[model samples]
Target: MRTTASFHSYATNHRLVFGDISSDPKTAIAKANTINGGKNGPFRAFIVVGKVFTKNNFEEVNGALQDGSVSVDLPMFFTDGEGLPEDSATNQTDVVDIAPNVTFLNQWGRLMTDDFIIQNATSGSNDRKTAPTDILITDKWPSNLPRLSKVGFAVPQTAERATNNDKTIDATSKDASPLYHFSGSESFWEREPFANEAGKHTRFIGLAPFGGKQRWHYAFTLKKDDTSTPVNATECPYLKEDKVEEEPLKRANEDDGDPMAKKPRIAPSDCFLCLSNPNLAAHLVVSIGQESYMAMAKGPLLPGHVMLIPIKHNPDFCTESRPSTNPRHRHPVRFVSPKLALELRKYQIALKQMHPGGVVFYEIAKAKGVHVHQQAVPIPQEKINNVENLREFFIKEAKECGFRMENNGELRDDQTNYFRIEFPNSDPIVIKLNRQNPKFDVTWPRKLLAQWFFGNKERGDWRNCSQTEAEETEAADKIKGDFETFDFTR
Candidate 1:
């Protein structure tokens, strides 16, 4: 059900009231009482309210709202069988959806009560045609009469329907009456072709000078230069996901910890090809390396999504990694080669051919402080499991990858167990390098310490957070003091 201005012509400017469930329990109870026929109340009633979906819960002033239109979210209620309204009563008769520029029930309150009601409304029309029209002029001097020029106009097809009757006019008759002539006839008569191929097929004339000769005529045809006729190709290539044969277990000597995890982590942050690893230094130095990197992540996340970011910072999403021959828009920083992008695509194809996932690519150019690197995200849509099933599958995969797991479940919140898979092959060396170069000095040790110390607190203690407020306050004050006295220079 909808309402427009035309339907409510008498009070189009007023707000309409609707019954609905209320935010307040008391108001809802009152509405329910009134509708349920308590002391002259109706036998049944319900309330509805329109809400906008937004970041917050449905709020009166700030919550979600759909622009230009309003949709009502059906209300909740508790009712006995006898109180249930008939399906028709609850449907077209009661619920209303409204939008702008549409006509709807006018004087709804009074009209709704009518046993059989009809409302009339009109919808507006569209703009008129702006196509150009052709004109023709002719000069004719009768041999024995005074010279005269004839000018006339007809709206092409508008005249055709007006005069359907056709009669041949003799070329030599020179009658003072309208007449039609065949194509080869010497006598000339204006033949306005159908707007739709009017002149070519069966001929039709819209208007003819009453038995007058046609000195000149205007007509439309295919443009002189239009030689190529558009051909619609019914045959198109179809793409189907390639099937992959699962590789036999050959336990990859890969480490359990993320190989590049200890390195500066960029997106493609999960497994697959990571751009931030120094192990990839040789590859990144050349164009081919970037593609190989993108390929690696493609298998695990299907429909491989990868972006080869240049080592240089580019703030734009579409920054070309390659230099353009034309310099006006040439990027100042180094870029990846087309060869590299092609190699990456090849790698993607290889992954797709052997993996269950598809490939997708996205580049992150907005690096705040992290090292510049392109990320390849593999989205294994097929491998995606519900959250409830994710843990077991991920664990199995980690084990298969030879990742050593250290159960840190005791150090988790919500009594949930934690499992850390160590890429022993990757982390120790990364940690060593990070220590040597302070730039990547992340909080691995501190994080572990924090987890061991406070990540897990009994549920009883968590429920009574205020009990530790004083201790937390003191700790914060001490930290603030320590920070205040620390050296300003790093």
Candidate 2:
């Protein structure tokens, strides 16, 4: 018997994570360059809308053009709202995160362009109502989208004017772009399809471009960071990459039994996690980047379990060799550097791609002490969307364990000691570990994952599931092979 392999009916939109609002186009481009494994090998274009941003704030969009990170691309401006007078200063999220045009209609069938005005307009109220036309899709379709025309494939022939409120028809222009709506050909303007891959769209799912929001849409692609130069502080004065803030690695408390939470101060030479440590398990190392490395977990909760470790002993993933030059006698703790962050992302994405199902990441970050490393485990595909679940799960499990877990929303990276549950497509759920109780189990995440994955909670204690050195080597080799394409170091 022959069988056919199945694929996701449509592509899923993955959001480009930008920490905060920035007017620098270089920062946005730099962030866009970091996405990997989304139906295509790399994204050729990215978009930034001028809505939630100041009116006509095209600084980053224009900056992207000047930096040569992207080509000169025209901005598509969305028409105004269908009212006697649509508000000019509306706050909207017009940035469209497109999914691949896998399905011809996207369950929208053949919605009309003026469907909104036709259904809602009242008679004798205003003489400015324009009759809406229809746009049909899902008929005879093309093998791909954006036909020969880079401008548009399905052009919006005619549409509703910004001053349309029914009753007496206002003098409408013969040539107007279709009113932006959730259905029909007008909806196509939001996605602005330009074929680039076999499946999946580069843009994450975004709102706005919905009905009304005057926006001059701008899109630009990221240049390969390798070929292009890095965005230095010279370009954007507040470039975070240029900053170097390090802290002294602290020794674990003598009373504390959890070894992962604390470590010795000083240098990599004395740290077990460092390459200089003679007892380090070299065979379990999967891939090593310039600043960071990944290795299979000593006792994996599952087959592909791994740890993202810095090449040096420090937890913050920064290295300071010239400590003597500093006026201060101590090393300031630098947060995750860009290179390290990219490597970490590549590794995490590599694991997620390998699993086909998604992956889960949990970290116990003790700022002052310990080699900060996060443990990743492959989870079922069904669980990937349940982003808020980890908090409730931990709360329930904590009560049974004779302890408590806080759904701490105010936790920041600078703060020490916290448990973080993370997913690729979702916001991380962070729970601050209470220092006073001392009842929190360090291995609680391991145990929970063990129960969910292996159907055996005992495996949470690595001792119970520990493998031989040879077996570990084999597991590492398999993972290394699977991750060959995804590994950025390779």
Candidate 3:
């Protein structure tokens, strides 16, 4: 039997800390002064230091980047109790501290330069062959003063090189795989892929891009525990994924076949979700710039529980990836747009308040193989106590939010939180629509504006479909050709 091997790799984005002229000594001093809350000028002393991982027979240390900087707690240059250089006339040499406490932020990475020193003497400093010889670096002359730019260890990229014993460390010997570089395609919160190799589980890790082309790398030894408890953060880097904003928009109107029968596909041209049923309207809870979703409430395996989606969707608030695309092809995912994110925040705050003590579940439908609207379901922990009760909760919620639920589903609500286009004092987009029709009444324009601005353009078929049956048929044909599937296995 031929055995196929698959290795899981991890990717992460981290900013570089030290590199280029911006990281010069003078520039570093200014930044340090600002961080210390002092005016920029001459300081008593300035330094830069860092920890680098080189391939050694005995692995003694590991490194990581924090807050766009590198961190390494290695041994100091020299221990305390060491005597300072004596003042000499003929061989005068100014001995600064071998280890000072100055930290330097560089483009390559942040350095802790506070523990080293520059040797300056009043005598013939070049003749300091008489200086301490026990140091790792002893000078025959005065040519080796380590600084931010001068200090760095080549990080090995290959697993063997990183884990092997060698004098001349080859940092770039790592295999040409995704694990060596960060995946620009994914968000920060998404865990890096992991795979098993020779009875050992290894996780591939990469850093965020810095200075145009370079990135960092790492290796995380994985634990065998499959049922590990989840961790939650207080001041989270992402929004609460469980927070409910707007209830899901219906997939298809009544008289149509099962909604799930249609596939979900994101279009490259407009970022609009082209569905099979045009008669069925989708009211997006979040704006085009914010990530949104439609999914089940208790679990994706559940029935009526569902989520409406945003084009730029995030599974969790901790780490999200948003690719920079052309404005025309961009999904309605925006983090900075005041018109969208602000309202989404309001919805999340409202959901947390309204469903006190309930757990909200979320998942992007864009998993590996499936394609459907990204939806989330809010399941009260108490509701899950009984299996039948849990199912009923989804049914009731779906109806209350408005829309007919089928396939062992029932309606619960009729009104959802979808935004309606209202004249925030008669915008121009509305004026243009009104001028196009003479016989069109005032109420018609208001409705048209709302539908045009906030409603699905494909849903315009609702006006042409004479019979309910015809509308459903037309929608079915539309969805089959355009939808894409989402895979949520991970």
Candidate 4:
């Protein structure tokens, strides 16, 4: 419906380019070059359009324009299910699936849902409409109008045409220069010459995805120069996440001050977490790596408990959280670099090896912002299989602690504050720490871990487990020596 509405708007304004049929789509499109070499010609741009053939929607927002409004990039592939900004929940509620394998939920959380979308459909146009260009199947015709889109799930389609054996599509988006290619089994080719003048028999405004070889009606033809770029593609706010695919990452700063305000910012020299801080407890330092470091727990819950901290001032989630190109988005969606994540996971593995029983890594992310630290504490080996049992306990305790716990069984893209807990051999648990609970107890997780895993509720309070400087220094040296063989940084 979104694509169809957009196509209707474009066809109404650019009737001449869309309504008129070319005995040869190529020759007629070639004519575009005659006008400013068709810089802003009838062939707006090349596009790969997805047609949604649901009974709920029948419209196709046809072709694309070169105004950088046309999009040719692959929508990207996912590993089954992953939370992403702009990604709409594809689970259907109102509709029922007749498949024997899966049962219908008949639930009602989703307000809007769609069925039968050709994810391969392109919505924008290209400059060289005459070349072996990408295939777009938005409504029936391509014209100069803004393209509209919504987050939904669909199986996309494309014409099997390509320029080389590599069979790659250079569908770099005007809005975003990402998605170089999708798997190339099918090749793309130019629209054939109606196969022996197929145009004389009948005309197709554009091919419809339903009713077996169907098309829509056309209107009057009037051509004029529409050198304007397609309106900007729909914009979705950038969100940071712990688990993300290979996408663009961005952010300037989380400065809430007025544009002109000269609010003082914390510097590494003064930050307690920074290695440069003069007041730092140097005796607690365990080992340092290129991008991260390990330090003994400030207040030891257990003798071997320690923290993995990023050397840079990153807040654990976003790698490119420093600068942003698009000002409209206060935060860019790309984050969770695989390389960095792999290293961090390796760090966790090292800790796990040191403790044959079990280990839990908990990171408290404050809504306001602070340097991130992943604290690894030991969990009894006998209790490893029972980690899932803690799920309900954590949830019940969270409410009493002044915050809510939401476990849709996936990691959320939290820009502000969230508490992440990875129990022994289980997927991480995340609880939102909304700013409303400013006085929320951050130490609550440690309390639970101490009681359930450490077998001592008293040690849950870090202050109770405090050690002297000399004792901490001696422990740190022993820890560095003990962990050297397992530490990847070494």
Which residue runs does candidate 4 get wrong by more than 4 Å? 1-265, 322-338, 381-388, 399-402, 435-439, 454-456
* lDDT per residue as tens, model 2, 85-201: 122222221112111210111211111111111111112321122222211111111112222333332333434211212212111111011122111122233333221111111
* Highest lDDT model number: 2
Q: Any idea how many clashes model 2 has?
A: 10
**lDDT of each residue in 155-261, candidate 1, tens digit only:** 32334323322121111111111111111111233333211111111121222221225322212221212222223211111111110000001111122223231
Instruction: Specify the highest-TM-score model's number.
Output: 4
lDDT against true structure, model 2: 0.43
Residues 1-490, model 3: lDDT tens digits: 2122211111111112221212122333334444333322222232222212123310222111222132222211211111222234212212222223322211111112222112211112211111110001111111111111221323323343233222111111111111111212111112323221111112222222212244321222222222222332011111222111111212222213343322222222212342332322343211222344322221122222234443432211212225446676343222223433454444344334433443232222211112224232233344433323333433343355443323222212221111111111121111111112222221232223223333422211222112233333344333322221221111
TM-score ranking, best first: 4, 2, 3, 1
TM-score of each: 0.17, 0.41, 0.18, 0.43
How far does residue 296 in candidate 4 sit from its true spot (Å)?
A: 0.8
Candidate 1's error at 180, in angstroms? Answer: 98
Q: Which stretches of candidate 3 lie over 4 Å from their true place?
A: 1-215, 220-235, 239-490
Cα lDDT tens digits for candidate 4, 294-375: 8998668877889987776654445444445778866445455666667778888888898877787888754224466889
RMSD values, in order shown: 31.5, 25.6, 27.3, 26.0
Ordering by lDDT? 2, 4, 1, 3
- Clash tally, candidates in order: 44, 10, 87, 38
